[model samples]
Target: MVHYLYLHGFASSPQSAKAQDLGDRFSRLNLSLNIPDLNQGDFSHLTLTRQIQQVSTLFPPGEAVRLIGSSFGGLTSAWLGEKYPQVERLVLLAPAFGFLEHWLPQIGEVQLRQWQQENYQAVYHYGEKRSLPLHYGFISDVRQYCELQLTRPVPTLILHGIEDRVIPIQASRDYQRDRPWVQLVELDSDHSLGNVLPEIGLAIQSFFSLK
Candidate 1:
């Protein structure tokens, strides 16, 4: 049996709109989509390496797996596909390609400096709807995983919003370039892609050849 999983974006959770929407779709199809909380209930200690390792444990041995990852989780899924041959396919939604490049600036130099000095900074968690302290190690740990090095040829499909100012559609465009195995679909929406979720669902269904 093929294992299906959904990995939510940074500061998001299993109850995210996109995750719930896709879960509902899978439910209607009599299929199950496993969504694990990458935060592990400790947002302050979260790291890219931790998230990747956490998801890796869910992969059943020798089982074909398909992943639907959003934003940061999309980045995680890409790396997983690279390292594990069992990850047969990937559907990335506004995947955070240049995560550090795009995210560090938004945090600002002063904030980053303070975070480095203090080892943690208050980050607004959209999932928890509250501010949580995030450690500097998050940025440092991610330095080792270069998305540019992800040249693994897995059957990948990326759904990115044309108006996404967060990660931007250009990130997906760059990822799809020179990677004949990867396909990108631009949606008319912003970073949240809330407006185009139904369209996204249909595209995912088509990508996986789902009925």
Candidate 2:
């Protein structure tokens, strides 16, 4: 049986509308879907790693798994795919390839170092009753990890919007440049492709069918 794992964007929860839509689609297709809640008070690299490890442990061995990740989760999916060959297909939506390069310049090294030393956690409101913390370690860890690892080119589907202000669509284009197994789909919407849900769903269905 094919199992689907949906990872929400940074600061977003599994309860997000996109996650629910994917869950519903998986149910209709009779595929198992896991949407683990990554919210933890620790709000550090250790916490996020533990959450991902715990979620990964729940799946029985020898089962085919497919991953769909959005934004930071897309980066996480890339890491997971590199670490685990069992991931049959990876779908990334508006992924940020070089977050450190993009953010560190604006915040500066001194402030980032200060933030890391102080270990401050600033809560930002996401959906209702849901919040995520701004953590220096999280940003630093993701940057370090991506830089250290080689790009793992598993069968990948990249969906991005031309008007994405958060993460530029060109990032996805650049990521797909050298990767032979990547498929790029550009839409006219913004970072939030809520309006193109049906088209996204169709693309996902078609990709899985090809496999």
| Residue-by-residue lDDT tens digits, candidate 1, 1-211 | 9989999999999999999999999899888999999989999999988998999999999999999999999999999999999999999999999999998999899888989999989999999999999989998999988777898899999989899999978889988998999999888888888998889889888888888
- Candidate 2 wrongly placed segments (more than 4 Å): 41-48, 105-113, 128-133
Poorest 10 consecutive residues by lDDT, candidate 1: 143-152
* Global lDDT of each candidate: 0.92, 0.75
Superposition TM-score, candidate 2 onto the true structure: 0.86
Indicate which candidate wins on TM-score: 1
Q: Write the per-residue lDDT of candidate 2 for residues 47-141, one digit (tens) a residue.
A: 33554575577556988778898887787777777777778799998876776666467667787777788775554546435444566666655
Candidate 2 residue-wise lDDT at 111: 78
lDDT of 2: 0.75
Error of 2 at 173 (Å): 0.7
Against the true structure, what is each candidate's TM-score? 0.98, 0.86
Least lDDT summed over 10 consecutive residues: which range in candidate 2? 39-48
